[model samples]
Target: MQTRNGDLSQQNGAESNSSSNHWQSQIAAVTRKLGSLPVQELKLRLPDWRNSLSTSENRLCDLLLAIQCSNSAADIHPKLTQARQEYEKFKFLCQTAQRVLTQNLTHYDLVSIAKISTTVSQPNTHDSAAGRSPALPVALRDRGSFDHFMQMWCIMTKHNVENMPKMGYKLLDLFQLYIQVEELGGLEKVDTEGLWHLVASKMGHVPNSQDATPISHIVKILSGAFVSVLAPFEEFYKERMRRTAAHWNICGPNVTPGTGIVPTEVHCNIANFGVVFGEVNIGLNDWMPEWSPYAKILRLTGMDLDQMQQQGWTDDLIRLITKFKPTIDAWREVLIKFLLEIWQHSQSMTGQHSLQHPCRPTIQFPTSQVPCEVASTIKGAFSIDEMQRAKLVVERLTQDILQTRQYQTCEVPEVQRLQMNYAVVDAHSLAIQFERIASLDYIVFDDQERTKTHLDQIALLKEQHQILQSGQQYYIMSLEEVVTAQQNFRTALGGIKNACVQKVKERQQQVTINFPQPDEFLIRSLLIKKS
Candidate 1:
C-alpha cells in the first residue's frame, strides 16, 4: 500500500512537469508583434526564456543603423527575412496562447469574467496547462491579465491621442514593425488580438452564458465594447481639434526676431501626432482580417474601412483653420509636414552640392539626438520646427521670384550682367538667394494680409534674376557675339555707350535705397485680436 501511494505521487509530479513544459513551448512559438508591453507589466507575464535585457531588443536597436543599412534593396531583403523568422517564432507563440485561452474559456463554456478583470494573476495549477501548446504572457492567456493590457492600452490611447507628440518614437517603431508583420501576414488576416485589445475588458456589459457561447455572440459583445471604448476618444478629438482649428494662428505663431523661425512646440506636437495617427490607421487597415465573418457586410457597411487620407496644403492655413469641422482628416498637419520636407530639402541643398536622395528628416534618424532635459523630440539639433521655418522661407522666396518673373529676366544677358546676381536662372543661384533672404527673417506679407516694404527689395531681386537668365541665354547663344558687341561698342564710341549705362541703371534706385531695417526682419504675428 505504501509503494502504490509513492507511485501515484510520482505520476502526478511527472504530469505537472509535462504540462508546464508544454505551455512554455507554445509561448515560444507565437509571432512577434509591434505592440510594446508596458514596462511595469513586463515581468507580469508567464516566465519567458528571454532575459530582461533581451525583451526590449526590438525597440532599443539603433534605428539609424536599421534604416541606413536597409536603404539598399540587396541588404533589406535578407534582414527582412531574418526579422520574419523572429516574427514567425512570435506568431507560433500567439497561436499557442490562443489555444490555451480557448481551452481556458472552454471550461466556462467555464470562463470566469470576474477573475479576468483581475490583473497579472496566474491561472490555477491545472488551468495553466490547459493546452499542449506553448505558454503566453499572463496578459494574453490569463483572464485577469487581459484586463491589465486592455486598461493600459486605453490609458495610453486616451492620453497619447490628446497629446500626439507624447506617443513619440513608439508610434514610429510600431509602424515599422507593423509593416514587417503585414508583409508576412498580408492584409487578409483578421487582427484578432486588436479586436480583443480594443474591447475585451468591457465584456462585462454582455450577459454571461453558462452554456457554450457562439463566437458571433461573443463578437457582438466585443463589438459593443469596442464602440463604448472608442466613444470618449472620438468625442475628445472632435472638441479639442475644433479649438485647435479656430486658434491655429494663436497655437502656431512665429517666435521673435534673431531667433530662427522654426516650428513652435505647438506645431511640432500637432505634426508628430498626425504622423502617429497615420501609422495607427495603417496598422489597423493592414491587420483587419479581410475574411472576417462580417467581411461581406463590411463592403456595404462603411465600417472598419481604411482610416488614412491625407490632403496637401491649402493656400491659407489661417483661413482653413477657422473653417475646420470635426472630421478626423481635418486635423492633418499638412502645412507642418510640407514645411518639414521643404526645410530638410533646403538644409541639404545648402549643406551639400549633390544628393543620394531627397533631403528629408526620417523618423528612423538617430535616437540620441533627443536628450532627456529638453522633454522634446523637436528640441534636438535638427527638429520639425526648423523644417517648418525652412518651408516658409523656401516658399516665400520661390513665390516672390515666380510672381515677379525674375527668373525670366536671366535670359537677357545684356539686360542683367551689370547687376542682379540673385536672379541667376541657369543654376540654383536664385534658390540660394531665397534661402539667404528667408534666413534674414524678413517679414513679407503676413497672415493678416498686411504687406511690407520688402516689395522694393523683391523687385530688385527679380530684375537680377531676369538679367542672369538673359546672361545664360546669351552665353549659350554665343559668347563670341557678346565679345563682338563689346568690341564694336568700345570702338564705335558714340551711338549707345551712354544708353547702355542708363539701361544698366534703369532698375537701380536713384537715391541710396533705404534697405529693410533690422527690426523689419522679424516675422509678423498672425494673431487676430478678439474684438
Candidate 2:
C-alpha cells in the first residue's frame, strides 16, 4: 500500500513538471514575436501598453526594447497583451485627430463670430496649442509627431469636399495655433503689414474687414506658414548668390550651358513644397489680391517689396527678380500646394546648385534678345485696316531684306574691306531697327479715336518710320550695285539712323515713359490705367 501511494505522487509530480515546460515555451514564442515589431510600431504600442500594464511612461521605450531584445520570453506574456491594447489606443488617437481636423468649425462652437470681427492678433503674441478646449495631443508639440495628423488631414480634406471650406477655416485656426506654439514667426523678422499690403495691392484693392468668406484669413494663415517654411530657402538663395557672384561675373551670366540667365543655374530645392521665390512673387503680384481678405493674405505671405530690395543687389539676384516680372499661371499649382502644406505637411527648404531634375520647367522665352520689345511688338500688332496697311509695309520691308540675295555680297572693294573689318554690316541691322520703330506705331495709336494731339504725334512717328524704311531699302539697293554711290549709301543710312533715334524720342513723349516698377509691365499697367 505504501509503495503504491509513493508511485502515484511520483507520476503527478512528473506531469506537473511537463505542463510547466510547455507553458514556458509558449510564453517565449509570444515575447519573440512581439519583440520583432519595428521600433516605430513598438513606440506606438508602448504608449498604450504603459497604461495597460501600469508601467512607468518614461520607461515604456526601455521596457519595450528589453522585451524585444530579451532572450527569455517567460516574463513577457503580460507585456505582449498590453502592447496589443496600446495599438488600439494609437488607432483611436489617429481617428480622433482626423475627425477633429475634418469636421467643419462652423458645426461646432469653434470660433466665435466675435473672433472673426476682431482684428489680427497683436504682434509677437502666440496662441497656445493647449488653450483650445480639447487640447491637441502632447506629442503634437513636436512638429514631426504630427505626421499622422497631417496624413489624416489630407485624407479627410480630399474625401470630404462639402466640408472643405470649413476644413480650411479649421485648419487655419489649428495651424495658427500650431505656429504660435511652435513660435515659427519668431524665427524670422517678417513684415506682416507689408505682406498684407502686398496682397491688398495684388487684389487691386485694399483689404476690407467686412469681406465675406474669410478667404483672406485663410490666405494669411497659409502665407505665414509659407513664409516660415520658405524663409530658409530665401536666405539660402541669398547666400548662394553671394558665394557664386564672383564666379558668375568671371564666367558670365550663362553658368549652365544653354541656360542663358544666371538665376536659372541656381536650383531651389524646398523639398516637395513646389514653390519658388519667383512663384511667391507672382502669387503676391497676381493671385492673392483677388481673394476676399486681401489684407490678411498680405500679413500671411510677409513678402515686402523693401525686403525684396534688401535681398542685396547681385547681378544674378537682380536677374532672378527681374525674370519674374510678367504674371504667370505656373504659381496656381504652387498656391494650391502651399495651402496643402498648411494641413498636409511642413515643407523643407534646402537650396542646391543641382537637383535630380528642375523643380519647374525652364521657362521658354522666344529667341528675342530684347524680350520686352518683342512682347511689346506682339501686344502692339495692328487690328485697324489703316494700321494693317502700315504693318504690311513693315512686313514687306523685312521680307525684302531677307529675300534680296544681291545685298548679301558686298560689291565695292571699300565695302568688302569694311565688311571684313566688321565696320559695314548688311542692311539687316537697319531693317530690324526700322521694324522695331514701326511696331511701336500701332502701340502708340492703338485707339481708333485718338486725341488731336496724339493723332498728330502718331502721324509724325509713322512718317519717320516710313522715311526710315524707304532709306533702309535704298541703302540695301545701293549696297548691291558695283558702282555703289558711297555718298548716297552714307546719306541713306544716316537718315534712317536719325529717324529711328528721333522716333524713339517722339514715342517716349507721346506715351509717358513710366519706368517699370519692380515686377511690373510698365506698358501693360499704362494700358490698364489709361485705356
Top lDDT model: 2
lDDT of each: 0.32, 0.35
User: RMSD to native for every prediction?
Assistant: 30.6, 31.5
Most accurate candidate by TM-score:
2
Model 2, span 1-531: residue lDDT tens: 999999999999999999999977865665555546554464465456446444343345666777789987668758766765565555444433322222222112212211111111112233334322122223344555444333333332222223222323343333333444333233222243234434324433333466543656645654564454323333332333333333222223333322112244232111111223323333344334333221322233444456556645445544554454221122222233333332221111110111112112111221112234333333323234645665665565445444642323223354353232121222222223323445344334443222222223223333333322222211222223312322232333344334434544566645433324322332232124211
With a 3 Å backbone cut-off (N, CA, C), the pairs that clash in candidate 2 are: 195-298, 196-298, 196-299, 202-289, 203-289, 216-293, 223-300, 224-300
Model 2, residue 241: displacement in angstroms? 18
What is candidate 1's lDDT per residue for 1-531, written digit by digit as tens?
Answer: 999999999999999999999977655543222123332233334235243224434633543357666656675656656665665555444433433332222223211211111111211112222322111122333435433333333333423323321111232222222222222231222143343322222322233566655545654543443244433433332333334333233123343221212243433232233333332332333333433211211221222222212223233422332222122222223333333433343333222222112111122212212112212211222334654675576567557656764222224354453322212221232222233333222222122121122322334434433433332222222233333333332222222223223333553553222222322211111121112
- Residue 285, model 1: Cα distance from true site in angstroms: 29
lDDT of 1: 0.32
